[model samples]
Target: MTSAIRPPAAVLLPGTGSDEVFVRAVFGGPLAALGLPLTTPKPLPGAAVVDGFLAELDRLADQYGTLLVGGISFGAHLAAEWAVANPGRCAGLLAALPAWNGEPGPAPAALAATLTADLVAEKGVDAAIAQAEAGSPPWLAAELSRAWRGHGDGLAAGLRVAARRPAPELALLRGLDVPAGIGACTDDPIHPAAVARAWAGALPRGEYGETTLAAMGTDPESLGRATVLAYLRALTAEPVREGPLEGI
Candidate 1:
């Protein structure tokens, strides 16, 4: 009898103010289809979200050896930075909706996150959700409604930290040799497609794909499938090197 080969393990982090539930919903189906079991850890409030995520990354690496790491928006930035720092450890990188590059500035996503955090802090979660729903598209409104409510005050704090977090430097990106997939949304303003294109362009082994928040809201699998399939294609073209893998 032939034995089944185990797929490499993947850990996906959620966007700012998002939780494991949200990440799982976004990635579970596509990852499972690709034979990867997804682990989405819930980050605690206070302390930079990136810091918490990095700690989780270390923990997961300890457990799994090499890992396939990825995330959405700010989470993507964290994953890319980690991958850059520990090039030999990552099996692959899936950076979805990467918001910006280089040092943090007045990026729209950051502004929105900060603004939303302020709103939540002053007006309260329910009021913030109402305002967001009123201003955003139906799909985004629904997503924020759920994620914001779930996060509560923590969401606000996370946004503040994410706003100040720096993006992976070009030097770091150029150093990454692992297979990478960048998922972008052409219409997204908060997470601009240009940034994704730049990231894909920068990485030596990066591939790019596109999916919309609307699609994700309706069929969460679309986000994962588009991104993972692109990464899988890159992996198939050039497999990961064999070595004693380290932690990221």
Candidate 2:
């Protein structure tokens, strides 16, 4: 009897202003169940965050050799960019809540990040959190409040940096040889599902999956399970052409 091949270890990065705790909550259990140990790194401050994450990825790659890498929202964009730059060094990619592709422009996620930064800068964290909580869903409000508070004054600078950073170009995405799973939230304006669909369509080996931010908020494990399942399916299938695919 043959033993199963173990999947590569996975490293999951959190969204902007979020810490490792949040990512662990969302991805830890499901990935662990799949026999893949998960690593969630706490982000750095300001313009250093992306650079810091890439450096961490490099360190992990040197240690593990072509491991699975993934992230949520802005973190997802960073992961994609790194994967594109370091081809053959990624076992697979799990992009959850991809905010935009290529140039940042007027993408809702960037705009919202900028606006939230301004609010935090002008009105202070407490006031900003109160206003954001009043307008946001309970889950989002809670997450933001904690993240914002944890980030403190540095949150504004980090948000500004994230707002301006470019996403991985579609042409680059089209060149990826590794399997990819894109997890999208159907009703999330800041992290539009259409962006995720476009990403799946662009990748040479990609599959798409849908779950709402609300659903993820209620059950963080849902995002992890959806993405892992989609990635597993993509690994078994032929490299998909650029087009719409049935959601996972």
Candidate 3:
């Protein structure tokens, strides 16, 4: 009996305005358990430069050979897009808290636009961080504040890039045959459970799991560990065989 080969690496992508540190914490250890390399490039460019994100995935597919791509929010949508186009090379996709089909609502965009304008003004990036973090959950606020401390003024420009990026289209997601896992949460107002169900339905065979950032972020390690284990289990499960069988 021939044994199936496991994916050689897992490329993790972060959500909007988030850095590699956050993505790593979400998938690093589970990857370690599977003896797989984890790759997370820098935050993707703005809507005008979205190809940078695609290019990184393309490069990883070329280098890794049967790669499993995963992401959160916008990153998840992008991962799904790449998996669809390069199904032969992709092992599966793991997406967490995906957003609307394409483009965020006006509320998030307005916040991002405000931060961009504030950074350009005299008060500097510190003022913008303080303003934005004020309304966020305590753990998230702390993480964003830390990023600001490290990157200073540059973080403001990154936020604009994040806010303006578009989501993947439904046509892009409907025909994929690879295994997929949709990680969702109940408390997240932006990521509706209905969307998760829709995405799951599109795949030939996909798994759905639930989680919350409020709990996950509080202890970042737990989220990464849980996500990776869930993903590995799904990927190793049997694929949905198509075109009639001997038994049928």
Candidate 4:
């Protein structure tokens, strides 16, 4: 994010049981405006979820050099985890709806995923999907239906694995000197706004912004803009170094 350098491409990821379509809806336009081409890699369901994402991130970073990485919820967690391990290869972050700081613990989002996984196991995907859609907002209901069905038979296992996976630790976050922009839905019980602020505070150069599930239900771009604009501010405010910012 220095004057001499910016990531050549961005790879945004989707949350558990979500898909590239949702990732595109949330981040594609904003990144396009910034002249950053976007790529959304689909998650491999079940225990392979984390490793699958890391492998694709490795491929993209190797192909494009430094990468601008970001995502929603577990997707955000995966992006941060990659940045922690590959700081030199990462240009910046645009994390939206971070569910927890480190381990899942009793985080609402994790619990929700765990319960849904159990439900799917007991009642099957179709029945679980029906129960989920009953009172959800029309937009959310539609999204849930599409994404859950899309996960197919792998849905339960994917949820279980993702629910158990830990996000990048705050100690790890402190080491990433890139522009770390964190976003949260203020009204989302699953992803707390405070957790987003904590992530922002943990990084050396970080910014935080707020959107809402209501806004997300209507326009996914509202979530994108909230996160990306914060990233822009962090980028602008970051001090340019005498040497390439590529090396940590």
Q: Candidate 3 — which residues are off by over 4 angstroms?
A: 1-6, 44-49, 103-123, 148-157, 225-248
Each candidate: what lDDT?
0.81, 0.85, 0.66, 0.88
For residues 1-248, what per-residue lDDT tens digits would candidate 2 score against the true structure?
Answer: 99987668798898888878888887787677667888888888766888899999999989888879999999899999989988878999998889999999999999988998898889888988999899999987898889888888788888999999999989999998888988887978889899999998898888887777778778877777667666766887854432333221
To one decimal, what is the Cα RMSD in angstroms of model 1 from the true structure?
A: 5.8
In model 1, the Cα lDDT at residue 28 comes to 83
TM-score of each: 0.89, 0.92, 0.77, 0.92
> lDDT of candidate 1?
0.81
Of the two candidates 1 and 2, the one with more favorable TM-score, higher being better, is 2
Give the residue spans of candidate 1 off by over 4 A: 1-5, 238-248
Total clashes in model 2, counting residue pairs 3 or more apart in sequence or in different chains: 0
Candidate 1 residue 149 C-alpha distance from true site, Å: 2.1
What lDDT tens digits, residue by residue, belong to model 1 across residues 5-69? 65658998888877777678777887776568889878777545667799989888888888899
The residue-by-residue lDDT of candidate 4 on 1-248, one tens digit each, is 65866546889899988888898988888788777889999888776878899999999999988899999999999999999999999999999999998889999999999999999999899998898889688888888899998888899999988999899899999999999779989999888999999999999989997889999888888888778878877888954331442121
- Candidate number with the higher TM-score (2 or 4): 4
Candidate 2: segments with Cα more than 4 A from true spot:
1-6, 238-248
Q: For candidate 4, what is the lDDT?
A: 0.88
> CA lDDT of 152 in candidate 1?
66
Residue 95 error, candidate 4, Å:
0.4
RMSD of each: 5.8, 4.2, 6.7, 5.7
Better of 2 and 4 by lDDT: 4
Report the Cα lDDT for candidate 2.
0.85
